[model samples]
Target: MTGWNADSIPDQHGRIAVVTGANSGLGLVTAAELARHGAHVVLAVRNTAAGAEAARRIGGDVEVRELDLARLDSVHAFATGLVSDHPVVDLLVNNAGVVLLGPRRTSADGFELQFATNMLGHFALTGLLLGALAAAPEARVVSLSSITHKSAHLDFDDLMSERGYRAPSAYGRSKLATTVFGVELDRRLRAARSPVISVLAHPGLTRTNLTPRAWEHRGRLGRVVARLGLLATQPVEQGTLPQLRAATAPGVRGGQFFGPAGLFETRGRVTEARLSREAADPAVGERLWAAAEELTGVSYL
Candidate 1:
C-alpha cells in the first residue's frame, strides 16, 4: 500500500456501495469516486434534497436515500428500505460523524448525540444490513474512526455522558467507541465464518463541513481557528483515500485499519494504522458490544 491514493481503487463494476452523509465533503468524494469506478452508489444522507443535488453532481448510477444516523428509528428505516430494494449490498462505508457541538445534546432516543450518530446508529445499521451484506460474494463494512480514539478513554459507568459533559472528551469517546465496534465486528464475523469483513479507516485532519460546523458557536476566535486549522489539513479529496482504500483496495483484511502516512497520521498517502491498546482489548469490545445491543435493541453475530 505504498503511496496509495483513490486512483488505486480497483474497478467496482457490478458492486453496490452505501456511503452515509454523502451529500458533501469526504463522503461526497467517496461516493463519487466509487460511482466513477462503475459501482452503483447509494448516497445515504439525512436530507433528501441535498442528497439529490449530490447525486446530480455525481451523475452516475447512484441514488439518494434518507438516513439520519442520530436516531435509531431512522437508522432502522434506512436499512430496511435499502435491503428491500437491494438484497445484496457489497460495501457499506459508515462515514457520517458529528464533532463537538460545544454543548451536551441527546438524540430522539435520549442517547448522547455524538455517541448515537457516530457509533450506536452505525452499529445497529450494520446488524440490520447483515443479511444483505452476507449475501454478497465478499462484502466489506468500513467503519470510519478517528485519531481522537487513540487518546480518548471510555467510561462505562457514564457512557452517555450523563453526569457531566465536555465537548472534546465526548467526541473523543464516541470515536473510541466506533473503533472498538469495528474491531469487534471483525472478530465476530470471523468466528461466525461469515463472508463479510469489517475494516476501519480515518481521514486525518481533513477539511470538511463538520469541523467548521462544530466550531461555529465559539465566537470570532472559533471562526479564525477553524479557518487556520483547515488550512493546515489536507483537502477532503486527499482525506478520503484511506477509507476508499479500505473499501476497495485489494488484499485488505478484516480488522485492518487504514490512515494517512504523515506524522501522527495527520496527512499523507494511505497506509496501515495502529490501534490503541484500549481499543484492541477483547474485554472492552465485549462490554461495548453488549451495551450497543441493549441500547439499540439490535442483535446479530
Candidate 2:
C-alpha cells in the first residue's frame, strides 16, 4: 500500500475525538490535525492550563479537560464526564505516556506509575467509554506502543519493578503490554462482532519533551542519547502519522499496527508495520489481558 499523509485523512465533520496528553508533542499534533479535519477534539490532559493553551493554539473546536492517568479516579471522572456530554466518540487516542524516569514510583492507586499511566489507565478509560465509542457507526481506539517493546518481557512477579528499577526496561514492558492489549482486544472484538476497532501505532524516535524528560531523570548518558535523538529524530507532526493512519485509514483493520516506514522502521512515511514475536504471542497476550483486568478493574469483554 502507498504511504499515508495528512491529506489522505478523510473529512471528519461531526466526529468527536478524545486524545490524552493533547497538550504537546505528537499528541498535540494529532489533536490539531483531527481538528483541522473538522472533528470536535477533546484534550484530556493532567494540566488544565497547558491543555487550554494547546487548545487555543490549535484554533479549533477543541475542549480542554483534566485527566490524570496516574490516578484511577481521575481517569474515571474524565471518561464519565465526556460520555455524559458527548453522545458518541468516533476516535479515542491513548497517547499520553511517560518514559524512563529515575525511580520506581507508584500511582495514586498504588500501581506502578509507568504501567498505570501507559497501559492500565488507558485500559480503564477505554472500558469506561466503550459504550460511547460503540454508539458511533465506526469508532477507533489507537494505543501508542514503541519499537523498544520488542526487547521487553512481561515479568509478572516484578511488574512494579520492586526487584529493581531499570527505567527503560520498565517503560518497554509497559508499552509491550499496551501493544499486546490492543491485539487481544481486536481478537475479542472480532469474535463478539463489535463495532469498535482497536489498533496500535508507534512513533519511531521522535523529538519530543518525553525524551528530555527521560534524560533529565536519568543522567549524563541519557542527556547524550537525548541530544542524539534530537539530531536524528523525525518531527512530531511526522511522528503522529502512524496513529492518525490507524485511526482514520479506511482500509485499516482491527489488529493492524502502524509505524514509520523508513530504514530500520525509524523515520519515514506511515505504513503498516509488523509486531515483534513477543508482542504477537497469544498466550502471553491472554495472561496480560487477565492481569490488566485484575489490576485496573476494567473489562470490555
Q: 26-70 in candidate 1: lDDT tens per residue?
A: 899999999999999999999999999999999999999999999
What is the Cα-based TM-score of model 2?
0.97
lDDT of 2 at 193: 94
The C-alpha local distance difference test score for the whole of candidate 1 amounts to: 0.94
What tens digits encode model 2's per-residue C-alpha lDDT throughout 239-279?
A: 89999999888878899999998977789988778898988
Pairs that clash in candidate 2: none
The positional error of residue 80 in candidate 1, measured at the CA in angstroms, is 1.4
Models 1 onward score TM values of: 0.98, 0.97
Q: Which one wins on lDDT?
A: 1
Candidate 2 off by > 4 Å = 216-222
lDDT of 2 at 174: 92
Worst 10 residues of 1 by lDDT: 209-218
